[model samples]
Target: MRSMTRRNRLMAAIKYLVCAIMILVIAVPLYISVMGGLKSVGQLRAEPVSLPNPVNWNQYTDMLTGKNGSFWPKLVNSVVIGLGTVGVILIIGTFAGYALARIKFKLNGLIYAYFQLGLLFPLAVAILPLYLQLRSFHLLDSAIGVILPQAAFGLAMMLMLLRGFIKAIPLELEEAAAIDGYSRFGFLFRIVVPLSTPILATVSVLTLVSSWNNFFTPLLVFNSEKKYTLPMGVMNFMGEHAADWNLILAYLTLAMIPAVIIYVLCQKYIVAGLTGGAIKG
Candidate 1:
Protein backbone atom coordinates (compact mmCIF):
# COMPACT_ATOMS: atom_id res chain seq x y z
CA MET A 1 0.00 0.00 0.00
CA ARG A 2 2.85 2.37 0.78
CA SER A 3 4.44 1.66 -2.63
CA MET A 4 1.14 2.35 -4.41
CA THR A 5 0.80 5.64 -2.53
CA ARG A 6 4.34 6.63 -3.53
CA ARG A 7 3.57 5.85 -7.18
CA ASN A 8 0.44 8.04 -7.12
CA ARG A 9 2.42 10.91 -5.58
CA LEU A 10 5.04 10.61 -8.31
CA MET A 11 2.35 10.68 -11.01
CA ALA A 12 0.76 13.73 -9.50
CA ALA A 13 4.11 15.53 -9.35
CA ILE A 14 4.80 14.71 -12.99
CA LYS A 15 1.38 15.99 -14.04
CA TYR A 16 1.93 19.24 -12.19
CA LEU A 17 5.37 19.65 -13.72
CA VAL A 18 3.97 19.07 -17.21
CA CYS A 19 1.19 21.58 -16.67
CA ALA A 20 3.64 24.21 -15.38
CA ILE A 21 5.83 23.76 -18.43
CA MET A 22 2.85 24.11 -20.81
CA ILE A 23 1.72 27.28 -19.05
CA LEU A 24 5.19 28.78 -19.33
CA VAL A 25 5.37 27.82 -22.99
CA ILE A 26 2.19 29.76 -23.72
CA ALA A 27 2.61 32.58 -21.21
CA VAL A 28 6.28 33.43 -21.93
CA PRO A 29 5.72 34.58 -25.51
CA LEU A 30 2.68 36.59 -24.50
CA TYR A 31 4.63 38.22 -21.68
CA ILE A 32 7.43 39.12 -24.05
CA SER A 33 5.03 40.56 -26.61
CA VAL A 34 3.30 42.79 -24.07
CA MET A 35 6.53 43.83 -22.35
CA GLY A 36 8.48 44.30 -25.52
CA GLY A 37 5.78 46.60 -26.84
CA LEU A 38 6.21 48.93 -23.87
CA LYS A 39 9.94 49.61 -24.47
CA SER A 40 11.85 51.92 -26.74
CA VAL A 41 13.49 50.25 -29.73
CA GLY A 42 16.91 50.43 -28.07
CA GLN A 43 15.59 49.22 -24.72
CA LEU A 44 13.75 46.31 -26.34
CA ARG A 45 16.84 45.22 -28.25
CA ALA A 46 19.11 45.53 -25.22
CA GLU A 47 16.74 43.84 -22.79
CA PRO A 48 14.26 41.78 -24.72
CA VAL A 49 12.94 39.75 -21.79
CA SER A 50 12.94 42.39 -19.07
CA LEU A 51 10.15 44.78 -18.06
CA PRO A 52 10.26 48.31 -19.46
CA ASN A 53 12.49 50.68 -17.45
CA PRO A 54 9.79 53.29 -18.00
CA VAL A 55 6.57 52.02 -19.47
CA ASN A 56 6.00 53.59 -22.87
CA TRP A 57 2.48 53.93 -24.30
CA ASN A 58 3.27 55.93 -27.47
CA GLN A 59 2.89 53.19 -30.05
CA TYR A 60 -0.52 52.13 -28.75
CA THR A 61 -1.66 55.73 -28.38
CA ASP A 62 -0.57 56.65 -31.88
CA MET A 63 -2.27 53.64 -33.31
CA LEU A 64 -5.43 54.67 -31.53
CA THR A 65 -5.47 58.42 -32.23
CA GLY A 66 -2.91 59.67 -34.73
CA LYS A 67 -3.81 61.30 -38.06
CA ASN A 68 -2.05 58.36 -39.73
CA GLY A 69 -4.39 56.17 -37.73
CA SER A 70 -5.35 52.93 -39.39
CA PHE A 71 -5.80 50.61 -36.43
CA TRP A 72 -9.27 51.79 -35.40
CA PRO A 73 -10.67 51.25 -38.85
CA LYS A 74 -9.18 47.77 -38.92
CA LEU A 75 -10.54 47.08 -35.45
CA VAL A 76 -14.00 48.19 -36.53
CA ASN A 77 -13.78 46.06 -39.65
CA SER A 78 -12.83 43.04 -37.56
CA VAL A 79 -15.70 43.65 -35.13
CA VAL A 80 -18.27 44.02 -37.90
CA ILE A 81 -17.01 40.94 -39.70
CA GLY A 82 -16.79 38.87 -36.54
CA LEU A 83 -20.31 39.77 -35.41
CA GLY A 84 -21.72 39.25 -38.90
CA THR A 85 -20.06 35.85 -39.17
CA VAL A 86 -21.36 34.75 -35.77
CA GLY A 87 -24.89 35.94 -36.57
CA VAL A 88 -24.95 33.98 -39.82
CA ILE A 89 -23.53 30.85 -38.20
CA LEU A 90 -25.98 30.90 -35.29
CA ILE A 91 -29.05 31.65 -37.39
CA ILE A 92 -28.46 29.20 -40.23
CA GLY A 93 -26.66 26.63 -38.12
CA THR A 94 -29.41 26.67 -35.47
CA PHE A 95 -32.20 26.05 -37.96
CA ALA A 96 -30.23 23.39 -39.78
CA GLY A 97 -29.08 21.77 -36.53
CA TYR A 98 -32.68 21.72 -35.28
CA ALA A 99 -33.97 20.08 -38.43
CA LEU A 100 -31.23 17.48 -38.33
CA ALA A 101 -31.79 16.87 -34.63
CA ARG A 102 -35.61 16.64 -34.55
CA ILE A 103 -36.99 16.22 -38.05
CA LYS A 104 -36.92 12.69 -39.47
CA PHE A 105 -35.80 12.27 -43.04
CA LYS A 106 -34.28 9.62 -45.28
CA LEU A 107 -31.18 11.69 -46.15
CA ASN A 108 -30.64 13.20 -42.71
CA GLY A 109 -27.49 11.29 -41.94
CA LEU A 110 -26.16 11.81 -45.44
CA ILE A 111 -26.74 15.57 -45.32
CA TYR A 112 -25.08 15.92 -41.92
CA ALA A 113 -22.17 13.85 -43.17
CA TYR A 114 -21.82 16.14 -46.16
CA PHE A 115 -21.33 19.16 -43.87
CA GLN A 116 -18.84 17.14 -41.78
CA LEU A 117 -16.81 16.50 -44.91
CA GLY A 118 -16.32 20.27 -45.12
CA LEU A 119 -14.08 19.98 -42.06
CA LEU A 120 -11.59 18.02 -44.15
CA PHE A 121 -11.00 21.00 -46.46
CA PRO A 122 -9.41 24.17 -45.21
CA LEU A 123 -9.95 27.56 -46.94
CA ALA A 124 -6.49 27.55 -48.49
CA VAL A 125 -7.48 24.69 -50.76
CA ALA A 126 -10.24 26.70 -52.37
CA ILE A 127 -8.75 30.20 -52.22
CA LEU A 128 -8.21 30.53 -55.95
CA PRO A 129 -11.70 29.44 -56.90
CA LEU A 130 -13.19 31.30 -53.96
CA TYR A 131 -11.41 34.48 -55.09
CA LEU A 132 -12.71 34.12 -58.61
CA GLN A 133 -16.23 33.43 -57.37
CA LEU A 134 -16.21 36.40 -55.01
CA ARG A 135 -14.97 38.58 -57.87
CA SER A 136 -17.77 37.36 -60.11
CA PHE A 137 -20.30 38.42 -57.52
CA HIS A 138 -18.54 41.82 -56.92
CA LEU A 139 -18.09 40.97 -53.23
CA LEU A 140 -14.48 42.06 -53.24
CA ASP A 141 -13.48 44.95 -50.94
CA SER A 142 -16.77 44.68 -49.01
CA ALA A 143 -17.61 43.59 -45.44
CA ILE A 144 -20.22 41.21 -46.82
CA GLY A 145 -17.49 39.56 -48.88
CA VAL A 146 -15.48 38.59 -45.80
CA ILE A 147 -18.55 37.83 -43.71
CA LEU A 148 -20.30 35.48 -46.13
CA PRO A 149 -17.40 33.13 -46.86
CA GLN A 150 -16.22 33.15 -43.27
CA ALA A 151 -19.75 32.29 -42.17
CA ALA A 152 -19.98 29.46 -44.73
CA PHE A 153 -16.74 27.85 -43.56
CA GLY A 154 -17.95 28.14 -39.97
CA LEU A 155 -21.40 26.59 -40.50
CA ALA A 156 -20.23 22.98 -40.66
CA MET A 157 -18.57 23.07 -37.25
CA MET A 158 -21.39 25.06 -35.69
CA LEU A 159 -23.85 22.51 -37.03
CA MET A 160 -21.70 19.77 -35.56
CA LEU A 161 -21.73 21.48 -32.16
CA LEU A 162 -25.37 22.65 -32.20
CA ARG A 163 -26.88 19.46 -33.62
CA GLY A 164 -25.50 17.38 -30.77
CA PHE A 165 -26.70 19.86 -28.15
CA ILE A 166 -30.18 20.16 -29.69
CA LYS A 167 -30.50 16.40 -30.01
CA ALA A 168 -29.87 15.97 -26.29
CA ILE A 169 -32.85 18.27 -25.50
CA PRO A 170 -35.69 16.15 -24.11
CA LEU A 171 -38.58 15.52 -26.55
CA GLU A 172 -41.01 15.93 -23.66
CA LEU A 173 -40.14 19.63 -23.61
CA GLU A 174 -41.31 19.89 -27.19
CA GLU A 175 -44.54 18.01 -26.35
CA ALA A 176 -45.18 20.41 -23.48
CA ALA A 177 -44.49 23.36 -25.74
CA ALA A 178 -46.84 22.01 -28.41
CA ILE A 179 -49.65 21.48 -25.93
CA ASP A 180 -49.32 25.16 -24.96
CA GLY A 181 -50.35 26.16 -28.51
CA TYR A 182 -46.78 26.80 -29.59
CA SER A 183 -46.08 25.93 -33.22
CA ARG A 184 -42.86 24.16 -34.23
CA PHE A 185 -41.07 27.39 -35.05
CA GLY A 186 -42.37 29.00 -31.90
CA PHE A 187 -41.15 26.09 -29.78
CA LEU A 188 -37.74 26.28 -31.41
CA PHE A 189 -37.33 30.04 -30.97
CA ARG A 190 -38.88 30.31 -27.49
CA ILE A 191 -37.88 27.07 -25.76
CA VAL A 192 -34.93 25.49 -27.54
CA VAL A 193 -33.14 28.84 -27.87
CA PRO A 194 -33.13 29.66 -24.16
CA LEU A 195 -32.22 26.09 -23.20
CA SER A 196 -29.37 26.03 -25.72
CA THR A 197 -27.62 29.11 -24.30
CA PRO A 198 -24.42 27.29 -23.45
CA ILE A 199 -23.94 25.89 -26.94
CA LEU A 200 -24.92 29.22 -28.48
CA ALA A 201 -22.31 31.07 -26.48
CA THR A 202 -19.75 28.44 -27.43
CA VAL A 203 -20.62 28.79 -31.11
CA SER A 204 -20.58 32.60 -30.96
CA VAL A 205 -17.19 32.76 -29.28
CA LEU A 206 -15.65 30.20 -31.61
CA THR A 207 -17.01 31.85 -34.74
CA LEU A 208 -16.19 35.35 -33.57
CA VAL A 209 -12.60 34.53 -32.70
CA SER A 210 -12.05 32.59 -35.90
CA SER A 211 -13.47 35.42 -37.97
CA TRP A 212 -11.61 38.09 -36.01
CA ASN A 213 -8.25 36.46 -36.67
CA ASN A 214 -8.81 35.41 -40.25
CA PHE A 215 -6.05 36.87 -42.46
CA PHE A 216 -6.19 34.89 -45.66
CA THR A 217 -9.82 35.51 -46.54
CA PRO A 218 -9.53 39.22 -45.89
CA LEU A 219 -6.19 39.38 -47.63
CA LEU A 220 -7.66 37.91 -50.80
CA VAL A 221 -11.05 39.53 -50.66
CA PHE A 222 -10.27 43.15 -49.93
CA ASN A 223 -8.38 45.26 -52.45
CA SER A 224 -8.95 48.55 -50.67
CA GLU A 225 -6.62 49.13 -47.74
CA LYS A 226 -9.42 51.00 -45.97
CA LYS A 227 -11.43 47.82 -45.63
CA TYR A 228 -8.63 45.63 -44.25
CA THR A 229 -9.34 43.68 -41.04
CA LEU A 230 -7.02 43.61 -38.05
CA PRO A 231 -4.91 40.70 -39.29
CA MET A 232 -4.34 42.34 -42.64
CA GLY A 233 -3.83 45.66 -40.93
CA VAL A 234 -1.11 44.07 -38.81
CA MET A 235 0.68 42.82 -41.88
CA ASN A 236 0.51 46.18 -43.59
CA PHE A 237 1.61 47.92 -40.42
CA MET A 238 4.59 45.60 -40.22
CA GLY A 239 5.61 46.38 -43.80
CA GLU A 240 5.35 50.14 -43.25
CA HIS A 241 7.21 49.98 -39.94
CA ALA A 242 9.66 47.15 -40.52
CA ALA A 243 12.39 48.81 -38.53
CA ASP A 244 10.09 49.62 -35.61
CA TRP A 245 9.86 46.33 -33.74
CA ASN A 246 8.39 48.07 -30.70
CA LEU A 247 5.54 49.54 -32.72
CA ILE A 248 4.84 46.24 -34.43
CA LEU A 249 4.75 44.46 -31.08
CA ALA A 250 2.39 47.12 -29.78
CA TYR A 251 0.04 46.61 -32.70
CA LEU A 252 0.09 42.86 -32.16
CA THR A 253 -0.60 43.24 -28.45
CA LEU A 254 -3.48 45.63 -29.06
CA ALA A 255 -4.93 43.34 -31.72
CA MET A 256 -4.84 40.39 -29.32
CA ILE A 257 -6.81 42.27 -26.64
CA PRO A 258 -10.35 41.85 -28.01
CA ALA A 259 -10.14 38.14 -28.75
CA VAL A 260 -8.55 37.48 -25.38
CA ILE A 261 -11.23 39.43 -23.52
CA ILE A 262 -13.97 37.62 -25.45
CA TYR A 263 -12.53 34.16 -24.84
CA VAL A 264 -12.02 34.79 -21.14
CA LEU A 265 -15.60 36.03 -20.79
CA CYS A 266 -17.11 33.08 -22.68
CA GLN A 267 -14.70 30.31 -21.62
CA LYS A 268 -17.06 28.71 -19.11
CA TYR A 269 -19.76 28.23 -21.71
CA ILE A 270 -17.22 26.70 -24.07
CA VAL A 271 -16.43 23.97 -21.55
CA ALA A 272 -20.07 23.40 -20.65
CA GLY A 273 -21.27 23.30 -24.25
CA LEU A 274 -18.55 20.97 -25.44
CA THR A 275 -19.05 18.64 -22.48
CA GLY A 276 -22.83 18.77 -22.69
CA GLY A 277 -22.80 18.00 -26.39
CA ALA A 278 -20.31 15.18 -25.92
CA ILE A 279 -22.07 13.48 -23.02
CA LYS A 280 -25.58 13.96 -24.33
CA GLY A 281 -24.95 13.32 -28.01
Candidate 2:
Protein backbone atom coordinates (compact mmCIF):
# COMPACT_ATOMS: atom_id res chain seq x y z
CA MET A 1 0.00 0.00 0.00
CA ARG A 2 2.84 2.38 0.86
CA SER A 3 4.65 1.55 -2.40
CA MET A 4 1.44 2.13 -4.38
CA THR A 5 0.93 5.52 -2.67
CA ARG A 6 4.48 6.56 -3.51
CA ARG A 7 4.03 5.55 -7.17
CA ASN A 8 0.76 7.53 -7.37
CA ARG A 9 2.46 10.63 -5.97
CA LEU A 10 5.27 10.31 -8.50
CA MET A 11 2.73 9.98 -11.33
CA ALA A 12 0.82 13.00 -10.05
CA ALA A 13 3.99 15.10 -10.05
CA ILE A 14 4.77 14.00 -13.62
CA LYS A 15 1.27 14.95 -14.75
CA TYR A 16 1.54 18.39 -13.16
CA LEU A 17 4.93 18.96 -14.76
CA VAL A 18 3.56 17.94 -18.20
CA CYS A 19 0.58 20.27 -17.77
CA ALA A 20 2.82 23.18 -16.76
CA ILE A 21 5.01 22.64 -19.83
CA MET A 22 2.00 22.56 -22.11
CA ILE A 23 0.67 25.77 -20.57
CA LEU A 24 4.03 27.48 -21.07
CA VAL A 25 4.18 26.26 -24.65
CA ILE A 26 0.81 27.83 -25.42
CA ALA A 27 1.04 30.88 -23.14
CA VAL A 28 4.52 32.13 -23.98
CA PRO A 29 3.76 32.96 -27.62
CA LEU A 30 0.49 34.66 -26.62
CA TYR A 31 2.31 36.61 -23.91
CA ILE A 32 4.89 37.79 -26.44
CA SER A 33 2.26 38.80 -29.01
CA VAL A 34 0.27 40.86 -26.51
CA MET A 35 3.20 42.44 -24.65
CA GLY A 36 5.16 43.05 -27.84
CA GLY A 37 2.14 44.89 -29.21
CA LEU A 38 2.32 47.31 -26.32
CA LYS A 39 5.94 48.24 -26.96
CA SER A 40 7.36 50.81 -29.37
CA VAL A 41 9.25 49.62 -32.39
CA GLY A 42 12.62 50.54 -30.85
CA GLN A 43 11.85 48.79 -27.55
CA LEU A 44 10.47 45.67 -29.27
CA ARG A 45 13.46 45.50 -31.62
CA ALA A 46 15.92 46.02 -28.78
CA GLU A 47 14.36 43.51 -26.36
CA PRO A 48 12.04 41.16 -28.24
CA VAL A 49 11.43 38.89 -25.25
CA SER A 50 11.11 41.53 -22.53
CA LEU A 51 7.84 43.00 -21.26
CA PRO A 52 6.93 46.54 -22.15
CA ASN A 53 8.29 48.91 -19.51
CA PRO A 54 5.57 51.49 -20.07
CA VAL A 55 2.84 49.97 -22.20
CA ASN A 56 1.73 52.01 -25.15
CA TRP A 57 -2.06 51.96 -25.51
CA ASN A 58 -2.37 53.82 -28.80
CA GLN A 59 -1.49 50.99 -31.22
CA TYR A 60 -4.58 48.93 -30.36
CA THR A 61 -6.81 51.99 -30.43
CA ASP A 62 -5.36 53.14 -33.73
CA MET A 63 -5.89 49.71 -35.26
CA LEU A 64 -9.52 49.73 -34.11
CA THR A 65 -10.20 53.23 -35.38
CA GLY A 66 -9.11 52.38 -38.95
CA LYS A 67 -5.76 54.12 -38.91
CA ASN A 68 -4.63 50.63 -39.83
CA GLY A 69 -5.53 49.02 -43.17
CA SER A 70 -9.25 48.32 -43.28
CA PHE A 71 -9.13 46.79 -39.80
CA TRP A 72 -12.72 47.51 -38.81
CA PRO A 73 -14.09 46.44 -42.18
CA LYS A 74 -12.20 43.16 -42.03
CA LEU A 75 -13.38 42.61 -38.46
CA VAL A 76 -16.98 43.26 -39.51
CA ASN A 77 -16.61 40.94 -42.48
CA SER A 78 -15.34 38.18 -40.20
CA VAL A 79 -18.27 38.73 -37.84
CA VAL A 80 -20.85 38.55 -40.61
CA ILE A 81 -19.30 35.47 -42.19
CA GLY A 82 -18.83 33.68 -38.86
CA LEU A 83 -22.39 34.34 -37.69
CA GLY A 84 -23.78 33.36 -41.07
CA THR A 85 -21.95 30.04 -40.97
CA VAL A 86 -23.19 29.38 -37.42
CA GLY A 87 -26.78 30.14 -38.42
CA VAL A 88 -26.63 27.80 -41.39
CA ILE A 89 -24.98 24.99 -39.40
CA LEU A 90 -27.47 25.21 -36.55
CA ILE A 91 -30.47 25.18 -38.87
CA ILE A 92 -29.29 22.24 -40.95
CA GLY A 93 -27.51 20.24 -38.24
CA THR A 94 -30.39 20.46 -35.75
CA PHE A 95 -33.07 19.19 -38.13
CA ALA A 96 -30.82 16.43 -39.47
CA GLY A 97 -29.72 15.43 -35.98
CA TYR A 98 -33.32 15.37 -34.77
CA ALA A 99 -34.38 13.12 -37.62
CA LEU A 100 -31.48 10.75 -37.07
CA ALA A 101 -32.09 10.63 -33.34
CA ARG A 102 -35.90 10.28 -33.24
CA ILE A 103 -37.31 9.23 -36.58
CA LYS A 104 -36.88 5.67 -37.87
CA PHE A 105 -36.47 5.45 -41.58
CA LYS A 106 -34.92 3.04 -44.11
CA LEU A 107 -32.15 5.38 -45.31
CA ASN A 108 -31.40 6.82 -41.86
CA GLY A 109 -28.29 4.78 -41.28
CA LEU A 110 -27.01 5.43 -44.78
CA ILE A 111 -27.53 9.18 -44.38
CA TYR A 112 -25.78 9.23 -41.03
CA ALA A 113 -22.89 7.27 -42.44
CA TYR A 114 -22.57 9.66 -45.39
CA PHE A 115 -22.19 12.63 -43.07
CA GLN A 116 -19.95 10.73 -40.70
CA LEU A 117 -17.55 10.15 -43.61
CA GLY A 118 -16.83 13.86 -43.46
CA LEU A 119 -15.25 13.34 -40.06
CA LEU A 120 -12.52 11.25 -41.66
CA PHE A 121 -11.61 14.04 -44.09
CA PRO A 122 -10.30 17.53 -43.61
CA LEU A 123 -11.21 20.66 -45.62
CA ALA A 124 -7.73 20.88 -47.14
CA VAL A 125 -8.47 17.78 -49.16
CA ALA A 126 -11.44 19.41 -50.91
CA ILE A 127 -10.18 22.98 -51.33
CA LEU A 128 -9.36 22.57 -55.01
CA PRO A 129 -12.75 21.19 -55.99
CA LEU A 130 -14.49 23.59 -53.62
CA TYR A 131 -12.72 26.52 -55.20
CA LEU A 132 -13.63 25.32 -58.68
CA GLN A 133 -17.24 24.80 -57.62
CA LEU A 134 -17.41 28.29 -56.17
CA ARG A 135 -15.82 29.77 -59.27
CA SER A 136 -18.37 28.03 -61.48
CA PHE A 137 -21.17 29.38 -59.35
CA HIS A 138 -19.81 32.95 -59.39
CA LEU A 139 -19.70 32.82 -55.59
CA LEU A 140 -15.96 33.33 -55.51
CA ASP A 141 -15.00 36.64 -53.83
CA SER A 142 -18.38 36.79 -52.06
CA ALA A 143 -19.13 36.15 -48.37
CA ILE A 144 -21.56 33.43 -49.49
CA GLY A 145 -18.59 31.63 -50.99
CA VAL A 146 -16.92 31.44 -47.61
CA ILE A 147 -20.16 30.77 -45.74
CA LEU A 148 -21.42 27.90 -47.89
CA PRO A 149 -18.22 25.86 -47.83
CA GLN A 150 -17.63 26.48 -44.14
CA ALA A 151 -21.19 25.48 -43.32
CA ALA A 152 -20.77 22.33 -45.39
CA PHE A 153 -17.53 21.38 -43.69
CA GLY A 154 -18.87 22.16 -40.22
CA LEU A 155 -22.25 20.42 -40.74
CA ALA A 156 -21.07 16.85 -40.11
CA MET A 157 -19.50 17.59 -36.74
CA MET A 158 -22.45 19.69 -35.65
CA LEU A 159 -24.90 16.98 -36.64
CA MET A 160 -22.92 14.33 -34.80
CA LEU A 161 -22.75 16.46 -31.68
CA LEU A 162 -26.42 17.34 -31.81
CA ARG A 163 -27.48 13.80 -32.62
CA GLY A 164 -25.50 12.43 -29.70
CA PHE A 165 -26.93 14.98 -27.29
CA ILE A 166 -30.45 14.56 -28.64
CA LYS A 167 -30.21 10.80 -28.21
CA ALA A 168 -29.44 11.30 -24.54
CA ILE A 169 -32.77 13.07 -24.01
CA PRO A 170 -35.24 10.60 -22.53
CA LEU A 171 -37.71 9.30 -25.11
CA GLU A 172 -40.46 9.60 -22.51
CA LEU A 173 -40.09 13.39 -22.42
CA GLU A 174 -40.68 13.55 -26.17
CA GLU A 175 -43.56 11.11 -25.87
CA ALA A 176 -45.08 13.11 -23.03
CA ALA A 177 -44.96 16.21 -25.18
CA ALA A 178 -46.48 14.30 -28.09
CA ILE A 179 -49.39 13.14 -25.93
CA ASP A 180 -49.91 16.74 -24.82
CA GLY A 181 -50.90 17.65 -28.42
CA TYR A 182 -47.49 18.96 -29.38
CA SER A 183 -46.72 18.56 -33.05
CA ARG A 184 -43.33 17.28 -34.11
CA PHE A 185 -42.07 20.69 -35.21
CA GLY A 186 -43.49 22.33 -32.11
CA PHE A 187 -41.93 19.74 -29.82
CA LEU A 188 -38.63 20.13 -31.60
CA PHE A 189 -38.63 23.90 -31.40
CA ARG A 190 -39.91 24.17 -27.84
CA ILE A 191 -38.53 21.13 -26.06
CA VAL A 192 -35.54 19.70 -27.88
CA VAL A 193 -34.02 23.10 -28.57
CA PRO A 194 -34.19 24.31 -25.00
CA LEU A 195 -32.83 21.04 -23.64
CA SER A 196 -29.96 21.08 -26.16
CA THR A 197 -28.66 24.47 -25.07
CA PRO A 198 -25.26 23.24 -23.93
CA ILE A 199 -24.58 21.42 -27.18
CA LEU A 200 -25.92 24.32 -29.21
CA ALA A 201 -23.65 26.67 -27.32
CA THR A 202 -20.78 24.30 -27.95
CA VAL A 203 -21.50 24.12 -31.67
CA SER A 204 -21.92 27.88 -31.86
CA VAL A 205 -18.64 28.57 -30.10
CA LEU A 206 -16.72 26.06 -32.17
CA THR A 207 -18.30 27.19 -35.42
CA LEU A 208 -17.65 30.83 -34.60
CA VAL A 209 -14.00 30.21 -33.81
CA SER A 210 -13.42 28.02 -36.85
CA SER A 211 -15.12 30.42 -39.22
CA TRP A 212 -13.37 33.44 -37.77
CA ASN A 213 -9.93 31.87 -37.98
CA ASN A 214 -10.46 30.44 -41.45
CA PHE A 215 -7.81 31.78 -43.80
CA PHE A 216 -7.30 29.29 -46.60
CA THR A 217 -10.84 29.39 -48.04
CA PRO A 218 -10.98 33.17 -47.81
CA LEU A 219 -7.53 33.47 -49.33
CA LEU A 220 -8.65 31.45 -52.31
CA VAL A 221 -12.06 33.09 -52.76
CA PHE A 222 -11.60 36.76 -51.99
CA ASN A 223 -9.75 38.77 -54.66
CA SER A 224 -10.15 42.24 -53.22
CA GLU A 225 -8.43 43.32 -50.00
CA LYS A 226 -11.59 45.01 -48.68
CA LYS A 227 -13.49 41.73 -48.36
CA TYR A 228 -10.73 40.16 -46.24
CA THR A 229 -11.53 38.73 -42.82
CA LEU A 230 -9.47 39.23 -39.66
CA PRO A 231 -6.98 36.46 -40.43
CA MET A 232 -6.52 37.77 -43.93
CA GLY A 233 -6.38 41.25 -42.50
CA VAL A 234 -3.49 40.20 -40.30
CA MET A 235 -1.59 38.89 -43.32
CA ASN A 236 -2.14 42.12 -45.26
CA PHE A 237 -1.22 44.12 -42.19
CA MET A 238 1.98 42.17 -41.89
CA GLY A 239 2.85 42.96 -45.50
CA GLU A 240 2.03 46.65 -45.21
CA HIS A 241 3.65 47.13 -41.81
CA ALA A 242 6.58 44.78 -42.27
CA ALA A 243 8.98 47.40 -41.02
CA ASP A 244 6.86 48.25 -37.96
CA TRP A 245 6.92 45.11 -35.81
CA ASN A 246 5.06 46.91 -33.02
CA LEU A 247 2.07 47.78 -35.21
CA ILE A 248 2.05 44.30 -36.70
CA LEU A 249 2.00 42.76 -33.24
CA ALA A 250 -0.79 45.13 -32.22
CA TYR A 251 -2.91 44.08 -35.19
CA LEU A 252 -2.29 40.40 -34.46
CA THR A 253 -3.22 40.91 -30.81
CA LEU A 254 -6.43 42.74 -31.67
CA ALA A 255 -7.41 40.04 -34.16
CA MET A 256 -7.14 37.40 -31.42
CA ILE A 257 -9.38 39.22 -28.91
CA PRO A 258 -12.89 38.32 -30.09
CA ALA A 259 -12.28 34.55 -30.30
CA VAL A 260 -10.63 34.55 -26.85
CA ILE A 261 -13.55 36.47 -25.36
CA ILE A 262 -16.02 34.07 -26.95
CA TYR A 263 -14.18 30.97 -25.77
CA VAL A 264 -13.84 32.35 -22.24
CA LEU A 265 -17.57 33.05 -22.07
CA CYS A 266 -18.71 29.69 -23.48
CA GLN A 267 -15.94 27.42 -22.13
CA LYS A 268 -18.20 25.83 -19.51
CA TYR A 269 -20.77 24.88 -22.11
CA ILE A 270 -18.00 23.63 -24.40
CA VAL A 271 -16.76 21.21 -21.75
CA ALA A 272 -20.24 20.03 -20.77
CA GLY A 273 -21.36 19.61 -24.36
CA LEU A 274 -18.28 17.64 -25.44
CA THR A 275 -18.40 15.30 -22.42
CA GLY A 276 -22.14 14.84 -22.59
CA GLY A 277 -22.08 14.12 -26.31
CA ALA A 278 -19.26 11.60 -25.92
CA ILE A 279 -20.99 9.71 -23.11
CA LYS A 280 -24.34 9.72 -24.84
CA GLY A 281 -23.00 8.65 -28.20
Per-residue lDDT of model 2, residues 164-199, tens digit only = 779899999999999999999999999999999878
Provide the global lDDT of candidate 2 against the true structure: 0.90
The residue-by-residue lDDT of candidate 1 on 68-90, one tens digit each, is 44888899899999999989888
Candidate 1 yields a Cα-based lDDT of 0.88
Candidate 1, run of 10 with poorest lDDT? 272-281
- In terms of lDDT, which candidate is strongest? 2
- Per-residue error (Å), model 1, residue 219: 1.3
Residues forming the 10-long window of minimal summed lDDT in candidate 2: 272-281
